[model samples]
Target: MQTELSKRLGVEYAVFGFTPFPAVAAAISRAGGLGVLGAVRYTAPDDLARDLDWIEAHADGRPYGLDVVMPAKKVEGATEADVEAMIPEGHRRFVTETLARYGVPELAPGEAAGWRITGWMEQVARSQLDVALDHPIRLLANALGSPPADVIARAHERGVLVAALAGSARHARKHQEAGIDIVVAQGYEAGGHTGDIASMVLTPEVVEAVDPLPVLAAGGIGSGPQVAAAFSLGAQGVWLGSVWLTTTEADLHSPALTRKLLAAGSGDTVRSRALTGKPARQLRTEWTEAWDDADGPGTLPMPLQGLLVAEAVSRIQKYEVDPLLGTPVGQIVGRMNSERSVQAVFDDLTRGFERAVDRVNRIAGRSAR
Candidate 1:
């Protein structure tokens, strides 16, 4: 389970868990893998700083990382007002109408919209990254594309490793040229924004493209066998997100958790731009279906589409009864049928790795003799 990255990070395994919940991040770090807190949900620098403080305190001195979304392409100089102005009346109407059709209730008076739609903005993501660098974070990861050269430089200046997720060999080469420390080769089955390539093909391509620089295989990796497969593809580690959603430390809502348990299957998810203006894999729901409809207003790009659905999603979450409610998850969700402690999940991964190694070695030994 050890690799150069794991050795550097002082973890027992190279199992990296990426979650929106700090508790989950801290738990994964304590359980001997790198836990990466998804910082895209944090709109304000102060809140992110405060949470990182908490994670540092709870991590028991284990190294952890932060995940931010900074797309390589975005509307430059687009302020909040500018982004808001771009949302057409037709798109707004479609969102409202779709919610009504789903019987989604309205937000109660004075209830805060519990989501951030503009996290993809460069300014906000950089602000969060700046605040993160002030802490003891060992790693900084960009989820969408190669981080700005200055951002990568600043992280390196602070002795932080910079990692970026890549969906293709070309993307991985971009990271490699940009002086990134690691590239997470994520496949189409991964949760959240991903490219069309599958892991089986993408991993080795990225591995060779970014040779000497460590690559983490991501996407559909949810078990020990999957973990072994990642290593076989020359990945130094595995980056997982969806598998952690069902863990006890996850901040998933009870209703959504129940839906994940009862309604989710490997084939029950869809990649749609409705949630974030990028095709992120999430559970198949009426909300996604409505957005995908040709009759509805087509989706916006980047922060705009996310802005359009932010309030609607907040309302759905608050009501907790809408069947249309869903969250970003990967195809591995089908295997995540039970709620378990972070320790239990880690134990399972370790045991699975051992069993897989034993089986492989036995087969090789038979052939050798």
Candidate 2:
């Protein structure tokens, strides 16, 4: 299960698990796989620093990475205030009416405020990168695009490797041009902001385009056979996200977990811009359908769309709004039928990789030679 990438990262397994849960990230790193914590949940620098402190204390000296989304193209000069101001009256009314129709309750006083759609914007992510560089992180990953030239230089100055997620070969090449150390070729079946290319078609193309630099395959990969398929496609490693959503360590809310377990299938998810401005894969829900409706207010772009629905999302989760409660998940959600610990998931990945290797050996048929 080891590759050059794993050796470079000082991990025993080349499996990279990208998750938002700090606990899940630490667990996977402790279990020999690279666990990359998604930093989108941490809008404030102090919050991110505190979480990294915890990860450092518990990761058993295993290296882990930080993932942040700073897109290459976004509305410039769009502050939180600007974004709020940009939300149309119709869109706001749509959110209000939808929540009312669903009977979703309002957040109680002192309840955690809904996530502000401010962090994914460049300014906040830059601050996040600064905080991440201050820690002893082994890798820094930009989810939406290549890291800025200065950001890459700064990470390199600290001996931290820079990785970026690419939806196509062209994007991979652009990352290379931007001096990215690693490229994660995430396919259409992946969770959250993805492009049209499927992993099977995208992986080998990215591999060839970014030769001499390692490419990690993502998208509809959940089983051992999928891992083997990724490697056969010339990927140096497999990056899994959705497989961990149902894990015990995952921070998914009860209603979301229930929906994931009882309803989600390979075909149950859809890619829509209803959640965030960009098209991202998520379980089908009334939230998405409402935005897709002909009579519904059309979705806004980027930070504005997220701003427009932030309160609605909070109310939906707080009240367990059944028809609209969903999270970003890939098509692999179908295989996530049961809750397991992070250690169990790691063990399964290892066992699956072994079985895949053995099957390949059997197919080679040494006796025939």
Could you tell me the lDDT of residue 141 within candidate 1? 95
Off by over 4 Å in 1: 366-369
Model 2, 242-262: lDDT tens digits are 888888887776655565554
Backbone clashes in model 1, listed as residue pairs: none
Best TM-score among the predictions, by candidate number? 1
Tens-digit lDDT track for model 1 on 1-369?
899999987888999999999999999999999999998888889999999999999999999999998988877566877888888998898888888877888887887788976678888998998899999899999988899999989999998999999999998998899899999999999998899999999999999998999999999998998998899899999999988888888777665556555468999889999898889999888788888989777799887898888999888777774577788889988898888888999999998987887778787785322
Q: Where does the lowest 10-residue lDDT sum fall in candidate 2?
A: 254-263
**Candidate 1's C-alpha lDDT?**
0.88
Error of model 2, residue 78, in angstroms: 5.1
